[model samples]
Target: MELRYSPFDFTVHEDPYPFYARLREEAPVYHNEKDGFWALSRHADVLAAFRDDRRFSSRNGIRIEEPFWGPQAEQFFSFVAMDPPKHTRMRGLVNKAFTPRRIAALEPRLLEIARAHLEPLLEGEEFDLIDFAAKYPTDVISELVGVPESDREQVREISFAVMHAPEEGDGQMHEGSTDAMGALIGYYAQLTAERARRPQDDLLSGLLQVSENEDRLTPEEVIGVLVLLIGAGSETTMLLLGNAWHAAWKHPAERERAFAGRIEDWIEETLRYDPVSQSSPRTTTEDVELHGVTIPAGEKVLLLSGAANRDPRAFPDPDRFDLDRDTGGHLAFGNGRHHCLGAPLARLEARLALTELAATVADYEIDEAAAKRVHTSINRGFVSLPTRVTARR
Candidate 1:
């Protein structure tokens, strides 16, 4: 049976692992000439591609082959799509903004936010985790980035537009598409200017403080970083929490064990089982041959991190979602330099959210009919997951 892989296909979106497994075993260097791209689906190949930044670069926007965003769009995301030196400098400055201390300091508030959103629905009644999961993380991160409480909803709307643009728009740069992006950047730019005038105890002010030899990010770059932070930090985390809950609900034994004790294992196993980010786009800088297949330079090569995580060559009995399995080093978060910037914060949020779910809800019933998986170019998770939670005695 020949397997076909399409990024925009709903069937593929609903479940892509079986096809991904075939890509690993049959066509490790799978090429989709129709979509005009190539993909590396195995663990070794994808990891190598990530390490070989010289050959496979992120310079050309990381959303398949997308014309490397126009000048205006570039200003808002150039740092993400650039190679070292430029990437290094931008990352260094941005690191100061997203400091360990900053995230650590926010833990109390993070937990509080998680509970605040969760407490209202923990009465053992039927409620969709998706509804609450979507906004809690966004609210927490937006406040940290200095977004006004009044504007968080607007920020979230923009984030959703950005995440879905690949599917809704031309899948690449198009006129008027940057309007939402512009709104997001304009909002952050205003915040950035305000921070410059009067500093605040927030990420925006921290960015203002991070200077390298009198060098600083332009307002555009700061806006870029903030935009990326909210977009990357919100949807992925939201879906992750949802995916973890859905995964637990599928595995009763594991769910039972998780309820009895720790939920960290559940998070780990869920990430390995159903990652939010199925792949990360990387463009080939030059022609490359892998697993007896030749891929021309400039061809978009997606490191299918989601597929690689399930490779039986790297994992034992890959299909089984076992909590006891040592799922350490899974590429649920990408590998190499472009590894997820907000991984620690993501883990912390999931820990708190799942821990609360386990503590407050005795057990839950998933209405699979109402549950819908997110169908987008580069995202995966439940869009609507209605559940019936039994109140804890």
Candidate 2:
């Protein structure tokens, strides 16, 4: 079957796996005329492209856009959309902040926030899980990363707007989306300066004090890192939580098993089954052969991480969300050097969020008809999820 996939398909918004499965099986390296990009779907092919930076560069950009945010998008400076030397140096500076120890340290605080958010929902009959469940990761990261309490609300708004820009662009830049992004930049700038003046015990402070010998990032680079850190840091994990919840609610027996100490496998299955980032974009640096298709230099390539995770050749019963299967080789986090730096943090957040949701609320069901799917060329998520939560208490 020839799969026809579009960024704006409502059918995909409902369930993109079937389309992904077809792509993996029939058209491992398929081209989309409308978008003018080749999509790599099979697990091995997708992983190769992600790892082979010499052939495929991140320079042009990482999204499927003909006229992306002309200048305001700011992804050019982001580590997500840069090539080596620059990508390496910038990533090194920020990597200091996301160290395993720091993420581990944030666990207690993350749990506290999770518990606080879940408290009100337990008392209510029904509520939006996206707002209450999927929404908390960024908020928690903002605090953990040292964005002040006063500016955190603006942080969430801008992060969401900038990250979830409508097809046109970030809503704020869209004539009248909001004044939040400007405020966020202003606050981040302040935080940046504050760290410079009086270095504290946090990531921002560390960025400010990065050694000159270690290849310092410019202030713009710093802002770009912060943008990726705050946005990428939370949005994808939030999707995982929301998507996993949707999955478990759809499969009650599996949901029960998840609640009963088998949650990690269920979470992995959810990621493999429905990843937040369905695809990542790359620009070819040289002529490359992808499954018999010749992609000339400068041609755009879409690494379909979601499709690869569900490729039958790579996974038995690819479409089935079975935790019993080995999900270790899945490319949900991409493969190779550009593999997500924040993945460990994302997993921790999901494990906590899912375990808590499963453990609490005696009965829960997703209001599928009422749920809203947030769409972007890169990330997939719920705009909102209205769910009825039956309290264990």
- Score residue 379 of candidate 2 by CA lDDT: 72
Across 255-334, the per-residue lDDT of candidate 1 in tens digits comes to 99988875888888888888998887777778898777789987778889889889887889888989899898588888
Top model by TM-score, which number?
1
Q: List runs of model 2 lying over 4 Å from the truth.
A: 1-3, 66-77, 168-182, 212-214
Expressed as tens digits, the lDDT of each residue in 1-393 for candidate 2 is 346886556667677778877787678778877766788888888888888998987776555554432233444238777778867877777786668998888888888888888778767788898777555887777866688767777777777775555645321124222344455566677778777788777777777667547567666677667766766777788888888888888878877788888878988888888788888888787888866788888787888888888888888887776667798887778878788898888888888877787777777877888988876666777878899877776
Winner by lDDT: 1
Per-candidate TM-scores read 0.94, 0.92
lDDT of each prediction vs. the true structure? 0.80, 0.75
Among residues 3 or more apart in sequence or in different chains, the pairs in candidate 1 whose N, CA or C atoms overlap within 3 Å are none
